[model samples]
Target: MVETLKSWRKRWLSCGDTENLFRDNPSNQMQGVMQLKATNSGMPMKVAQRIDVSKFMSYIKVSRTQLNHIKRLKQSGDGIQTKHVSRVIGGLDKSHVKPYGALLEDEQRRLREHWLEMSCNDLPAAFEVLRERKVLMEKSIKLLGLELQQKNVSVLRKVRCDLSFNSFS
Candidate 1:
């Protein structure tokens, strides 16, 4: 058991942890990529590939600390303002940034980057906007159809009334 633990520690230190973890956990890998992009907006994946893992880890540590502080304050019934949460989560990207900054091969990095670009313009917000727009368009079309149906019903009622009066006369 001790030897297994030691081997795992060594593997983690040598930067083998990320591949082993992310290979099976696509959700975690995606979160890491999202956090990287959030922290450094408009940063190309090629640039992200060159990021210093130690520095990235340091930033994640600090950001996580700040977030914990905010969480503690909120739990203690302290009047933690939105500014505090935003400062840690939005400004630091602490909420989304996962600890998976190991170096990847060029081909892997390129493939991930290409997938991100093709699917979402490199940001999830773009996909969200498209989805929302589609929903709104569908709603509007349905509403218009309902309005037309109502108008036809009213006209039919009026025509029936006229035909009855003429037949009686």
Candidate 2:
């Protein structure tokens, strides 16, 4: 019993008693990415925030692969395999794609740039371009609303119609 206790103590000390007791430290620590300096009275101040494009690209690649897999599964009529689909979807959900939200912003910025380059007389033509590209969907209903507002026709009246059958009378 004494020998066993001694052996246990030796093992504990050799392994560092608190090592496994603590949670694993996050790999992406801010200090490693950013340089901090002490301001007045020893307060740490962040100098800059850096964006690692390669990391972002890796995330994009993973998301694209998952999306392609889902699409292929759908096309092949093997969608009944819910486990694979769920795993892919879940992985995508946890990915950085949703958090970034920059894709739509970039598209909108490009469209705005294209619109601004055109003359006032070309406003309709610009809208036509957007429509042709299928970029103007229900999400852009406000644009349609503005167009409708500018027209002399009453949108509400056009939508409302009476249906009646006189055969019974």
Candidate 3:
């Protein structure tokens, strides 16, 4: 299951001080943490006697207040001897897809120029594709302009109300 800070603190602190927790605690902290004892040291572990709290604090990366809080948790000794927790990674966001902007501006410009040149030279038969695209774009622009003009005329006609009332006697 996903472990939160509170749960982590509870589990870690419950391991019962660096004395009981870190003695044979080769599982969780084995990677970067200092192993104070050889599990095979054959000498049974001791706590609070040898570990200078100041030096210990440096290794654990917590403030005195936090350490005191941790000290208060019950040393329930759950999976204290158990080791190895698997990590979970979430799905990638759009940022991860093009993290560095796909290509630099100068490179992108050069690429576009190269692509245009290649298509015109190598694919001469496909010249109609470009021509068709240009034609369609021009047609869309003209249609939009005409629609805008018609809307403006209708709006103006509505705004200028010519109310000529005639009476038949």
Which of candidates 1 and 3 reaches a greater lDDT? 1
In model 1, the worst 10-residue window by lDDT is: 98-107
Q: What is candidate 2's lDDT per residue for 1-169, written digit by digit as tens? A: 3544675477677675566532334453343223332223376666544354423543233567878878888888655487777677675557555323365566689888887766555777878888876754764887888887867356554444222233334
Candidate ranking under TM-score, highest first, comes to 1, 3, 2
Could you give candidate 1's per-residue lDDT for residues 1-169 as a string of tens digits?
3544675587678775585732666786577667765777755565444356445552233456776887786887768887876766565543444454432344489888899787776467777899999999999999999999999999999999999999999
**lDDT (0 to 1) per candidate:** 0.69, 0.59, 0.53
Query: Of the candidates shown, which would achieve the greatest TM-score relative to the real structure?
Result: 1
* Clash pairs (backbone) in predicted model 2: none
Compute the lDDT of residue 118 as modeled in candidate 2. 68
Worst 10 residues of 2 by lDDT: 32-41
**Each model's TM-score?**
0.29, 0.23, 0.24
Q: Report how far residue 137 has shifted in candidate 2, in Å.
A: 42
